[model samples]
Target: TKETKLIDFNQCQQSSIENFIVNGNFPYESLEKFLVCFPKLCSLSINRLVRLNYLTEKDFNPIELKNLKSISFELHSIYFELLKALFKNFFKYIEILTISIYNDNGSNFFDGEQWEDLISTSIPKLRIFDFQHHYSGPMDHFLYACHSGDFRSEF
Candidate 1:
């Protein structure tokens, strides 16, 4: 029903929808579809109950979206290495980000330094970051140091 509504929305040729919530897959073919369909999109929320296919860096990159500030995603089987550039480039102007993703490796996402550097350098505009991480292994087994301050810097 939701996909149908999205399709039906295509009928309104001149429509410029600002905010979109996607419950299923949005097969962008390439990220260009987001730009072509919703040029004015500011806030985007996507909930993927089932991943039809794994996402890679190539699946990202809809450039010049200055209006897009808030984005949320529910993903599975994603690697931080693969999407590092997307965080750096694709979400350059993002002020708020929310993500719930399942990953097998803890080396990247579990590391506070990586996140701090990424946020400070790449997503400089980021103000609020809400994250839910899911992993298959015992996260405690990973050797990491506990910092004195918050998880932001000096971590």
Candidate 2:
């Protein structure tokens, strides 16, 4: 007899999948495989993924996904670099992006100066970008600038 690897709800739960919980670590390898296999995944939530280090655009096989719409996550303090890499890779087809950062640690999750950079560099086709930082103020100024006609002129 031989053992087999099966992907099911029970298998997902038994794995290191942290769903809707604080301070959970998601194995990016399994997650990438899961996403590739599960095409009908509409919404995904991984709260406070402390050890989630990297998510690059190359990891996603776009042809496999058909209905994936939303992804919510709480970023730990040390994963800012990973987030930057992830954003730099993905986010082109993302219609919505929601991020929550740890406030007590004093981390700058998405700065105002970076808005132009993000638009110019990574997410050029991004239609909507929503950010929620526990320590930072709202991105109203950047939103206004992006919405105003002046922003379009640059494009």
Candidate 3:
């Protein structure tokens, strides 16, 4: 809290930042406040290391992520609900999407049946679809990963 308080937003003018990296467990309210300072944010990456995190609908009201073009998240226990919220609010013009998931929950993330329609609706301008998810319990992980430069066809 002390560190956050030290960065006075009133003294500093609007920022010109374009990219940001963060931990997935970071509080939504705090992150939303911090990102509002940078109106030009175009890329975001969430490094969720090894921990499994459940998606929290804690009212993530990002100030201005309208210019966001690329997003990458290390998705372990995170769900589609989080992604849907982000896409609805900020990923309208997004071009690149990279995601990774780890656990026995492969089917939840790897089901690509809705990819074409989702891209058409929420992320119409999407160009690259890079994704990976896997898990293993005494057995190896079941996985489906890809880095498709052109997302319109051959998905």
Candidate 4:
């Protein structure tokens, strides 16, 4: 008797396994292999995986995967640097992104000018931005920067 390996895409489908999970600190190469193997995957969830820190744009290259519409993850103590890197690199085709953060350490990551620059450069295509914070700071500032005309100026 001999063991066998799945090489062809159709063969892997016929093998009768679905919904793969990669846990622990594995290299991005393994993730890439999984994505290549299962291009028809509809949903992928990465939970509490610290190895995700090593993932970058290169790992997402072969991910023109069909039916991949949603990605869900929990990120605690997320630094602005990681957010910048993630947004800059991946999720070009993603329609929805949900992120949950725990505990606010009262750190201001961006100033008015920095926020303006970030909005202009990074998230041009974003239509809906929902903030769950209790008190939002300076709504007018953001609106004025993003929109051309002023409400006061109109009146």
TM-scores of the models, in the given order? Answer: 0.65, 0.51, 0.66, 0.41
Off by over 4 Å in 2: 1-25, 28-30, 52-67, 104-106, 135-155
Single out the weakest 10-residue window by summed lDDT for candidate 2: 13-22
Question: Backbone clashes per model, in order?
Answer: 0, 0, 1, 0
lDDT of each: 0.61, 0.48, 0.61, 0.41
Q: Give the TM-score of candidate 1.
A: 0.65
Model 4 stretches with alpha carbons more than 4 Å out: 1-30, 52-62, 76-90, 102-155
Q: Residue 74 error for model 4, in Å? A: 1.3
Between prediction 2 and prediction 3, the one with superior lDDT is 3
lDDT score of residue 118 within candidate 3: 70
lDDT (C-alpha) at residue 11 in model 3: 47
lDDT of 1 at 46: 74
In candidate 4, how many Å is residue 78 off? 6.3
lDDT of 4 by residue, 1-155 (tens): 33223223333432222354433222322344555666665555554222324444332443454355454444433445554444444433444444433233113332335434444575444443332222235664454344322212210
Q: Give candidate 4's whole-model lDDT.
A: 0.41
Task: Sort the predicted structures by TM-score, highest score first.
Answer: 3, 1, 2, 4
